[model samples]
Target: MIRLLLVDDQELFLQGLAMILESQEGLEVVGTALDGEQAIARTRELQPDVVLMDIRMPVLDGVSATAAIRRESPEPPPHVIVLTTIRHDEAVVDALRAGASGFLLKDARPEFLVQSIRAVVEGQQVIAPAETFDLLRAFAPVRPAPDASILAELTERERELFALAARGLSNADIARQLWVAETTVKTHMRAILTKLGVASRVQLIALAYEHRLIEV
Candidate 1:
């Protein structure tokens, strides 16, 4: 079963979500926290596979909390899905930089939420297609330029993998497109992460953009 931790300031919403998630097969709401502090504490103790975190909270916000939790966790930190009302481009960029596995609207459908958790746990991203254009536009004014330097860090195959990742393609999608095994894609991704000095795919994209290695 996929273990989950819910962290949101809304008591009613947290409890309601816990109940709803618990009812779903192959998933379990392992714990709930009201703020970023409690969320970090519970995470240290529970070590859940995924954390459903709210962006705004009383003590600390989701972005800071995600960064803290990610730093404290062992390699391969637990996946974090930011549940927020804010869909602003800045917020999305900040959340991704903070190491969140995904940014999802608070009212996302239950099935989608569950799928996001599973996808993140499986080392795949789950960006909402509805927000893709908006996010891409956020970086449109100064679109990335061609940079041959990035190619030095990746092998030919790894470059192909990173290109797909730069385009926001999931591992499964990249695997199918390349006619390679998903495990191979994952291996290339790990090398990309190490060479690029980024912990998550979000940062990978951010770095790629900063270095003019990839265009949106």
Candidate 2:
């Protein structure tokens, strides 16, 4: 079962989300927190597989909390997905930079939310398709061009896969597109992450955009 922690200041939202998630098979709501500080504490105590975190909260915000969790947690840290109400908020980028696996709008369908939880746990980044372009565009102006030497390290095939990932394709999608096994796509993705010195696929996307590897 995928263990989960829900963090949000709104009591109703948090409880409702917990109820919905618990109703799904293969998922367990291990705990819930009202803010980032509690989220961090619960993460250490419960060691959940995933955290559904709200971007804005009292005590500490999701981005900083994500950074702390990623930096301080032991091996196999919980994957974090920032929950936000806005579609194109810059905080999503900040949260990703801080090691969040991805972002999801608060209004996402229940089924998509469940699917995203499973997807992230399986090593896929999960930004909503509609928000992908806008999120990338929001980061374009401020990001420095990606390091050319780092970009040069990718093999031709790796570059192709990287471009696909930057375009918001999941590992399964990339595998199907290239007629390769999903494991092969994952292997390439791991190599890409290491070569680019990035922690997540979201960062890879940002780098791709900054370097013009793929059109926005």
Candidate 3:
């Protein structure tokens, strides 16, 4: 079963969302929190498999709470998907930088949200690639003297896959573009992540932008 924790300041939304998710098979609503501080506390207590976190909240915010959860959690730490109202908000980027698995719009279809939770558990990012690419372009700053030597750690094929993934392409998309199996792309991605020491593609994108490696 995929254990989940929901975090949002709005009580009504939390109740409604939890109802929808709890109805689905293989899912369990383990807890809910009204603020980031509560999120941290509940997460430590429950140790859920996933957390649906709202980016804006009182007493704390999702980004800070995500950082704390990821930093202190045990092995196979919970996957955090940040929820937001704005598509191009910089806080989403910050959340991703702070170790969120990805961002999801609050108005997404229930089925899509449900699929995202499952996909996230399967090591797939739950986000819109094109929009996320645009978001990175807008908020990711370019250094005057960028250092991307860490990219050298990747093998040639891994570097190619990294470039496509940094541009927000999915593993399946990369597989189609590279004329390989999706599982093959997934393998390369795992190797790339381990080589560069990034936890997810979001962090990989952040690292690429930090080093000005990807052309904006």
Candidate 4:
């Protein structure tokens, strides 16, 4: 089962999410917190598989809480999906920099929310398309050129794959674009991850921007 903990200041929204997710098989709502501090406490106590953390809260904010949670080594920090009303807000960037696995807008559909949770828990990252462009542009001016030395390690095919990845293409999308099977794309993705030393595509995009591998 995919155990989940919700941290939101809005009771109605929290209850609504719990209600929507409870009926789904293999998905469980293990706990709820009205603020970031409680969320951290519940995390230490419940040890959930995923956390839906609100970016703004009373006692502490999600960014600081995510940083705190990540600092606890060997305890296995839950993958966090920061919930925000604004798309690509500076707070969202701060949360990601602090090690959040993903971000979801509060207005996102229930299905999308579920998908975000599943993706993050399974070691994938998801950011809204608009948010991605915003993030890329944040580092555009001062970003260094793509490290050709590091990229030279890539095979020709891997080079193409890396470029598609930097453009935020999904494995399936890259497969279609490259006329390869999805499983083949997965293999290339693993290679890309190893070559880039990135945990997820969000980080990959950030690195690509930082290295000027992709244009703004």
On the 0 to 100 scale, the lDDT of residue 86 in model 3 is: 95
Per-residue lDDT of 174-201 in model 1, one digit per residue for the tens? 8999999989888889889889777678
In candidate 1, list every pair of residues with a backbone clash.
none
lDDT of 3 by residue, 1-216 (tens): 999999999999999999999999999999999999999999999999999999999999999999999989998789999999998999988898888888899999999999999999999888866777788888976677778698877788998998899888888889999999999998999899889876778788878877888775
Candidate 4 has a TM-score of: 0.82
**Top lDDT model:** 3
Please report, as a residue range, the 10-residue window in candidate 3 with the lowest summed lDDT.
128-137
| True-structure Cα RMSD, model 4 | 2.9
Task: Compute the lDDT of residue 49 as modeled in candidate 1.
Answer: 90
Lowest-sum lDDT 10-residue window in model 4: 139-148
Model 3 ranges off by over 4 Å: none
- Please list all clashing residue pairs in model 4, or write none if there are none: none
> How far out, in Å, is residue 57 in model 1?
1.1
The CA lDDT of each predicted structure is: 0.80, 0.86, 0.90, 0.79
Candidate rank order under TM-score? 3, 2, 1, 4
Q: What TM-score do all the candidates reach, one by one?
A: 0.88, 0.90, 0.92, 0.82
Question: Can you tell me which runs of candidate 1 are displaced by over 4 Å?
Answer: 129-133, 139-151
- Model 2 Cα lDDT, one tens digit per residue, 129-205: 44766786766453454445556889999989987888888888999999999999999999998888777888787
Error of 3 at 50 (Å): 0.8
lDDT of 3 at 31: 100
